[model samples]
Target: MTGRRVAALAAAFVSVAASAGLAIVAPAAAAPGCEVDYAVPSQWQNGFTAAVSVTNLGERVDGWRLTWTWPSGQQVTQAWNATVTSSGAEATASNAGYNAVIEPNAKVSFGFNGSWSGTNTAPRSFALNGVTCTGEPGPSPTTTTTTTTTTTTTGNPVPGDAMAQVEAMQPGWNLGNTLDSTGSDETSWSNPRVTEALLDNVKAQGFKSIRIPITWGQHQGSDHVIEAAYLNRVKEVVGWALADGFQVMINIHHDSWQWISAMPSNRTGVLTRYNAIWTQLATAFRDSPGRLVFESVNEPQFTGSSGDAQNAQLLHELNASFRDIVRRSGGNNASRLLVLPTLHTSSEQARLDELATSIRGFNDPNLVATFHYYGYWPFSVNVAGGTRYDATAQKDLTDSFDRVYNTFVARGVPVVLGEYGLLGFDRHTGTIEQGEKLKFFEHLGYYARTKKITTMLWDNGQHLGRTSFQWSDPELAAQIRSSWSTRSGTASTDQVFSARSGAVSAKTITLNTNGTTFSGLRQGTTELVRGSDYTVSGDQLTLTAPAMTRLSGSRAYGTNAVLTAHFSAGVPWRINLVTHDTPVLASATGTTSSFSIPTTFRGDLLATMEAKYADGSNAGPHNWTSFKEFDRAFAPNYTTGATTLTPEFFAEVNDNARVTLTFHYWSGATVTYHVTRSGSSVSGSP
Candidate 1:
């Protein structure tokens, strides 16, 4: 998927070359022998995703411009590649930015995804490389039309470059996940199965970004590690979204509290385990492209206020460690944009700075800070804001947005409004008064640009009542659609990217397996990319991609392995991988190698691996077994480490089909095995 693409809009230019005082005749057509073939999904033929493919019949083209007309009453709703234009019944095409040089025999394609209301016939007339298409003439060749009908669609995502486009192209939506499970649609993450329809609804309403807050309660019981099944479940959801062309964010959501709260005195041990978890997590997804992003941790909370700088210092301690974790992980994540949290995830409160400020100095070039807009937590809910004070009390709460965040704006720091909305659920609603909330949207957008910040809707897929301005609220949806749009024809450098981890430059990984050394580009957790630039290899993957204002990378699974990657920039870069599994063997950087199965590691276990940056502020334990649905042949990382059998932890195979097997490991320890049966348990192993 490279080379010239079609421009969304069409233009016409006639030349008049005359050395003498005489008008010179111009060619009737700009493109001479171009041809086009178009086919879109039945659901797309009319809506936003109008499929248009162009071919070169005569010369190869460096770029292309595709323009056509749908019958009399049809037109393009939105366009990309080239600008689109429409007249009464005619359509035309022209160059976009630079000239579309058509070689003697090559062609290219370009198009945009848009939504439409009523069904419209596909345009039959088209132009390519430098010629007209074979289809019957559609409308006149001059006047073009535009559609008013609205259709919502997800961006198309491919491995390499498409992910960046997806993030930039995606509309905003709220992350349904949080640290502590709220347990219901009103507060916490909804189950994935139940959330599918909600996602489709999101796309229908035209949203592109979704932040999935995850809690790594994987190993809640032991080894101070995360679990595999939990990570597997998260991966399942991420895969679905990426396959749907989505820009997703998977961060250490609730575990921030779990890791930070009820602190233990063994700080060094905590740091060691914490660092280990990140190392393992980073290695697992070493092959992921760029469609995915890694949000280091959710809001870093503190019980104390300005008086307790010590607690703040505790938060700051993670700054250097977190950076080392990411830079060492290798691949695009090296320089990928990593998101950090502030004191309590508050722009105003966090404004005091601590880890929020230190994170700014990471070796990685693409890093951003994250904050939430709870504004007046309990007050907004009406429960805390207090029942009186009329207008004055509300103003007190409102000043934070304008007064507090303004500080960060002054510092030129990039931030994302992680959580913010008028919570009018079964609980309360007072973040804003009335229509005034809409102003929040507009102001936020304008302010972000001025402040150079990014904002995400607290959430948009919640089942909270639609009557109020919530996830399901139609009014809220309308506000987002109206206020946030890239219709101005001008583009911004800051894009909501799917890849937020980092980048790699001439990356090479040396593996030590059976005393054999292997080297190549290290794979990154990034979920999207431009296919022409990178590829995956062996269990340890490597890649190098361009780092621009708009492209970044992140991890899919929470913790995996460590990688040593060299980039054109940054010295002694360090990344993090967090996992419960023990690394048996790997490279010096810890990116590639094998893991020694724990004596307790056994069963038809499912393992999920994820990567995180070393900013190691918040992380959790993870087991290397849980992801079962993935076809292992295609993606081996999903395979479980090992399985064991223990009476208390084992399951039955069947009643009559009992089979027995003996323990063969060198040592005797409790083994947890996976068993599926319709009836009874077998006396021994299957």
Candidate 2:
């Protein structure tokens, strides 16, 4: 149902679509030998990244070609690690030079970026080597449901400026995994039926707003008519929030599956349903308090990778339709504040710009921009089983919030962190950690308050008990309240100082505070140790020797030989930086061989190694080959025969990373090498 609590990765499902206007042309079935899993890793306005993995369940073929049809007009832009060709709705992807061979029971992957017009739909079927691949088909067409509900327009109206209303909702909570449950029953997913007492408990804990993410599409028919039972149930729950003096936000939760985000072909259908849904909702709540806010959609994203321009246009149209439709519904809806989501509801600078640009020129004083932030992945959500939050993690989190503030809040646009919370899963007990989740809540609460951004904590019976109407851990709940309470007085008055470096030998940096006195001088969240890390003289800050050690990774260095990297598949790696004046190695082609490192300036010049590889496509996990940096005087030259050389400074090194390199020979012998790196040593055995 697109509930924030439900992990989308584990429940990844394929969505297949047949040509809307074409005859039912069944593909020819070849001998059962392989299976394929096709996926859309990402999508934007008019483009998307498509990936497919093929497993040789039978005898291996020297080469393979995977084919699929595009229901709407789509064109391939570029492909990596594979050769892709498209003709109308049909397209084929074959392996590149080094990935042509496959052994029995082995799997290979390929992917491409494609553009689309009108509507975008996933291929209904896929074929490998002219045979239909066996695997799960796409989501089937949902049945349309129709129901009629008695009209009721009743409730007191809220008063205040839209921004003031938003500010009033300082700390919020999401009634997640309850009414938004995808199961047949509300309690099927293990959360008890939401009760008034639960709302009371939430309010008692200092939460001022409750966001209800309801899946209207699931309860609607093909014609987009929402069943009366479902609509009334949502209204009842929202009523509870409003009655408890809580700000309420209701949105079209899981509308992507309904093709609401698809444009052109399904544009008409999508708009029709979207407008109808809001019209009905606005009419029902015509007399309700202004606290009952309407959200356009949750994570309103195009199905495939769509270009930003296309996504921006689609989002614009959808948001305009929402604002226009709801306003025309009369009653308190005429001036009710609305929430608009950015692309992917992401905190990315580019996506935020897209949203700001799309909604520019239109004067909507009663609107609040919203985006979701769970910036520290693997630790925020712990998807990859990581359990540490280091200095870098904290810096990233701060930087993300800083961007949002500068982009939206600073410019007079009120924003809300619609949904944010780290997963509570504990690695030790294999159960949700009520206590551990508090630390994250504490941090988020502090960040949100300082940024002056309204925040809604996502809960799905994980942190609080629904049946008992009590917190699973009262101390955890108390910690959240305490964090929020800190914002009761003055906000943090620390000013950020950038260590601008132009020359490699520059040691003194100036603070741009314009004579304003400030402390807590940090370089990207790493607070400088005054006497040891750096020394300040007036408005100038000078770096100490420890700063260089921290940057060069010298203190952590050891006598290790070569740093070898093995990729899951052949991927390009570019070393050295190039500018308009001085063009160095702009590109390099050795994926397995060692290279000569070059000197780089800290800020003015950067010798970077950027590897581009599609996650889970044409390659397995490339642990070490992600990104690396070397020091200014660092240079490493390793000989394949027996040579050794000099000790170089490494700014950062993912020393021990597992990489699987696949090699396909013209002689039909496929060889696989497993590479391991420790410190600077590179060793691999096939």
Candidate 3:
């Protein structure tokens, strides 16, 4: 599983500004005029990253080239969004294919990583297309002021009790993959534009708060000025949520990784842009009630820092600046509840401690600590043979929550789980088994409630259908809702497997009563007799042989029957009666470019695959673990009756080595096979 919450796009924008104290050279009247903003956002002992934005002030130019002479022996090591070449002390950058055109008064930006000597100073002069730039653009254009009318009746008055206000914002929902999308617009990620009706639908579903994650980089222009249209759109959505009585949270979403991550090197530029963003936002919503919360940054992380210690210090600086700007902006922001996150919004002990220190330093009671939880790594993405929500996953959750609870909640600092969901859910809901996914949510909700951490479900139009405004899995949604109030009983396994060719034996499931009493078990509307069909002793629910055989009608493969375990309260647990046998694998010959083991699943479902060499070392991609990453190194196609080993897996494995493959099925059956690769040719044996 990945450590970051969201996968960052490659072409993220960095903060840019013209270097001050740099000498300027005047160009001839016939020469085209240009202005450049050269900023180094990240710098270390010997390396640094720089972002450059060049604006054409002269006639329209179809293509542009920027040249600058390093004053302190800085060398361009690598670059992106533009092509940079260095010779001696001078360096030149040419626009990439897409950004080749520069309309009159328009700007284009690019970034690069470079090396520096003892003293890394900004370049003294810059020339665009052989013409020396004045370093200053023409007079500023007229700025339009959007006057927002303040309505006292919009939201509840700002509450003095921060803890109480945070508690009231329980059961939050995230409007993800919408405004936060880094594409051209909100709909760039295929989610519809935010509508008041959508907010109404979310409110109807018991969500008291909404997190609007907006990526402001793409919508910003030179000098880090956010476009008026984009700012207005965000305000419109925030207003809708507030009008619907939602505690709204708006933050610098993707921009955290985009530009904010360069704070260590470009502290001046990053802080300047960051302060401008918050100043505008604070000014816009200054009159709004306290329900409007401002999060400093989403998953704030710093690159090129000395270490975690330096990263923590950088985050503190940003948080401090954010708080200072918002508070001084006046109106409701003076005492408005502000949320600050640790590095990457992680719940680890170190990250939590750093956040606690920052909060204590602020000495503000209206402050809240924030973090994100995406479940345990392996089970989250169904990697490393972790296909179940076992003790390990449970312990991970409890330990994380316990640390945060002890560090903050117990000490009177409110905590908000800014985002919570399985990482695999982002790919597709079925990436993890339905039963295991449900159990995870059920346990997560209960534990978070006990810890007093408000969880905002990160729904990127996967769990909930945006158009229909209904959950794809109503049962999963119901379980999450129930977990908010009380704990729900769950079974060890939601499935019972019976061999198709043999006589069925009794199947027992360990129930986690979780303080709830089990009512009975039923298949559809027919309730099974307790003595004859099943028996419940203590926390064990056992299905007799006769009942198992009856449930496995015709001894068919796959799910034969679905049984619901009803509890005295909360949502019922589903128990699927499946008939499956040991899966069969066949030998095959192919090339490393493409290879697959013909499989006869025989009604069994594939769980995960493990690959190991003769030396007992891991093989294939993610070689640190014997079990290859799901869907990346290998994928099971039930319809094709084959398990395909992707080229990515073969690309990493030794060319002429034999690797043992173990296929694990959900039915608890494991099959071993061997495959040998010679050059590009491969052969498998069962």
**Candidates' TM-scores?**
0.41, 0.51, 0.76
lDDT of 2 by residue, 1-686 (tens): 24332343222211001111111111111223677877988999998888878886655454456678878878777776555656677776755434656776788887778888777788888776666777532222132112101000011112238768889988888988777666655676788777889889888878899999876766777777788887888888889899999999988876644567566457787788888888888888989998888888988777553444567778888888888888888899988888999866766454565565444434566778898865465454332323334454566567668767755676566788998765434221212223224445655777877788899877867677776767765655665676675421111111111222212121454432311243543444355477776676765655565454344342211111111111122111111111111111211111223423231222112122222222322221212223211111121222211111113212132345544433221112233334444555655453
lDDT of each: 0.40, 0.56, 0.81
Residues 1-686 of candidate 3 have per-residue lDDT tens digits of 12344232101100011111111111111216788888988889898889899888866554456788999888776777665756579777765534656888898999988888899999988888677889555333222112111111111123348889889999999998999988879999889988888899999999999988988989888877889999998888898899999999999898998898999999999999999899898899999988999999998888898765688888999999999999999999999999999787877555665676677567777998898888777787777677889998898799779878766777687889999888775464346888898899999999999989999998888778887999988888999999989888889888889888788999999988788999999999999899899999989899999998888879878899999998888888999999999999999999888999999999988788899999999998766578866776777788898888888889988988999999888888999999988989999999
* Backbone clashes, each candidate: 143, 20, 4
When superposed on Cα atoms, how far off is each prediction in RMSD?
Answer: 28.3, 21.2, 18.0
**lDDT (Cα, tens digit) per residue for candidate 1, span 114-225:** 4445665567676542245663333332332221011001111112332233236334565454322534222344323334555565556666766777655544436755
Better of 1 and 3 by TM-score: 3
Pairwise lDDT winner, candidates 1 and 2: 2
Better of 1 and 2 by TM-score: 2
Using TM-score, give the best candidate's number: 3
